[model samples]
Target: MKVEQIYTKCLAQGAYYIFSEGEAAIIDPLRETQPYIEKLEQDRAKLKYIFETHFHADFVSGHLDLSEKTGASIIYGPTAQPDFEAIIAEDNQIFEIGKIKIKVLHTPGHTLESATYLLIDENGKESAIFSGDTLFLGDVGRPDLAQKATNLTQEELAGMLYDSLYNKIIPLPDDITVYPAHGAGSACGKNMQKETIDTLGNQKRTNYALNQPDKEHFVVAVLDGLTPPPKYFGMNVSMNKKGYKSFHEVIKESYRALSPEQFENLATTESIVILDTREANVFKDGFIPNSINIGLKGSFAPWVGSILVNVQTPILLVCDKDTEREAITRLSRVGFDNVWGFLEDGIQSWKEAGKDLDKINRITAEEFAEEFTPDAVVVDVRKPSEYATEHVEGAYLKPLSDFEEWVKTVDKDKPFYIHCAGGYRSMIAASILKYNGITDFKEVDGGFGQIKKTKVPTTDFVCPSKL
Candidate 1:
């Protein structure tokens, strides 16, 4: 028997592949089906089932396309009301794949239809549990995401999560491996560990969510410090539940190459957004005027989804020649399917065509330190928690995730400095600021990481409650 965890670092998501005796099963696949199809061909195994823990809110699932191509039955836990055909397995129901068995453990509260799949090896010993969002290595799924759909308050959902963990999951064998759907950097859980896999016994002892004394404590602890989820979450969930355009179709339509003049015309004539997906350093040097920069090297999809909240927004790409396909694919993963086309031959083509170019003013951390003034306006684009930990004493806390809303209040005439934990998010903020015509600001290169190393005064780490 072989079990593999296919981890995508940018999304911080894991999809599992289990094989035994020439039969294979896939759990929580991504939007593309070609990779899985290739895996099956390589192993010479026939896929029998595709398991979904719940309707995912982060990225569209490939269950429909995978099942259609392979004739595999798509399985979901009880209470799933998908528009497409799927077998809704009952709690404790078991399915066979060659010599191994997969038992369904209905564990809702991440969503009403969440479940964990327990793998019973050929030896009939419980071996591993694919603990979806129901349980993470150091934290459990946030309960607030399902509130509107279920008409349940977050507290009530948190209570249900507590019961799901205590009654359904905690009783599992200590030595059994725990494979979760997401790791750190995912919005699904606030405090997930960086490690993707852990032993159940270790989690029981080390995970704060698993060690809660009672359900009340568990609910309170899990709900604490959760920022609002990205606006694109519900749209992705809807697409997952109701099915979407095939991944192949999205790529085929969006991969069209546009000349510099055509790309410029599209941006001027249509209500389209220009998304530049080069690296932050490359993008800051030169880019299309008024384009938003969410670099492909960083958390590209999530940042795109957060800033461009509407999935249906029309977009034109300005990417490195090699990254155009990847830009479109990643955008489609987050339900951004209205991508029109990409600038052919990248920024060089635009330059050759004598198109107007825009650039951001950036300064080194040491330069910022020398120029620092007690009353100078400084904007910190890191998250709330990071700011609470330690930030420049009087820096304005305008987090990059909430850039759209806070950007409206920027004083275009006033000059300020902006920074994030590192340079990635601050560059994104800088591009957005430039796009909005707020150009009097300079972005601090190396961000707070380098700023903290300088003589600039920063607040000592303060307890969150005191802030």
Candidate 2:
């Protein structure tokens, strides 16, 4: 038996390809099915099964598309409510192909229908378990995702997770390998280990979730530090369950490259969403007016998922020529396929076309201190946990993710200055404000790092140094 791990860095997701003899099964595929198809074709393997551990909330899954294309059976746990054709996998249901045995284990904590699949060699020795989101290398899935309207509270869900971990997963042999769906930077769980795969023994020894003495403490530990889910989570979950629209079916609408004059005209004619994929600092220094800044620096897809609602809405791309493919690919990962082509030569093209550009005010920490007044509202746009750590004194904490709500509570007319840990997120927050017509604002040049270097009376809260 041969096992291959396919990692999609854009979505921070992984899919597995298992081959026994000439038959293959794909587990938890992403929306883009081309890569898997190409692999199977090259290997000369018949596609037999497409398995979904659960309906993913973070991104769309490609179970339906692969099944439709390859005439493969779509399989999920008994409680799953997939809209397309699928077989309900029963607990301990075993299937064999070539030299491998696939056994389904119904592990429901991350979601009601979540399953962990065990792979065994022909000799009956367990090799690895596709643990899905129920268990990760260092952390467990956050229990709040599927409990929005359910009778189960966060505590109840976490308690279920403890059982799923201790009762179902922990009993597996120490040397059995564990492969999960998501890795670091995934909102599916807090503190996911940077490594993609780990042994059950390693995790049992070092994983904090597993080290907890009892279920009650374990429940509190996992539930306490979770960030709020992205706005598009529910939409993605529902879309995945209903079977995501196939990527092949997405029509590539032809769009003419806009001349500078035409681009300006479109911007003025109606509200056009301009997505600038440059670094945050560059965007803050100068950019086209009314553009929503989503830098390619970190987790661009999830942030785009949070702000964008209409996938069909026209988007004008503003990126360096070298990053065009990356920009398009990342957007497509989240099903944002309405890219109306890129600027012919990127921002340089627009500048050469003699279009008017806008500049955002930026000030250094020392300069900001000189201009500081009690009336000036200083906002920190980092995460709440980051804010709880060292932050500028007297600055109101409004993380970039929750900036929309925080903006409403502040007096828009007041002079405002914003900064993140680095300068990056501050630019994003500034762009968001500018897009909403909050014009009188400035972003700190070096952000908190620069501010901390200077002598200042600030309260420091303990947090992980890596962040």
Which structure among the candidates has the greatest lDDT? 1
lDDT of 1 by residue, 270-301 (tens): 56899999888888888999999898997999
Candidate 2: residue 403 Cα off by (Å): 0.6
Residues 287-324, candidate 2, lDDT per residue (tens digit)?
88888888887778888887675555677878866777
User: What TM-score, over all chains together, does every model reach?
Assistant: 0.98, 0.90
Prediction RMSDs, each to the true structure: 1.4, 2.9
Model 2: residues with Cα > 4 Å off, grouped in runs: 148-151, 254-256, 265-272, 309-314, 364-376, 465-467
Model 1 misplaced stretches (Cα beyond 4 Å): 462-467
Give the C-alpha lDDT of model 2.
0.80
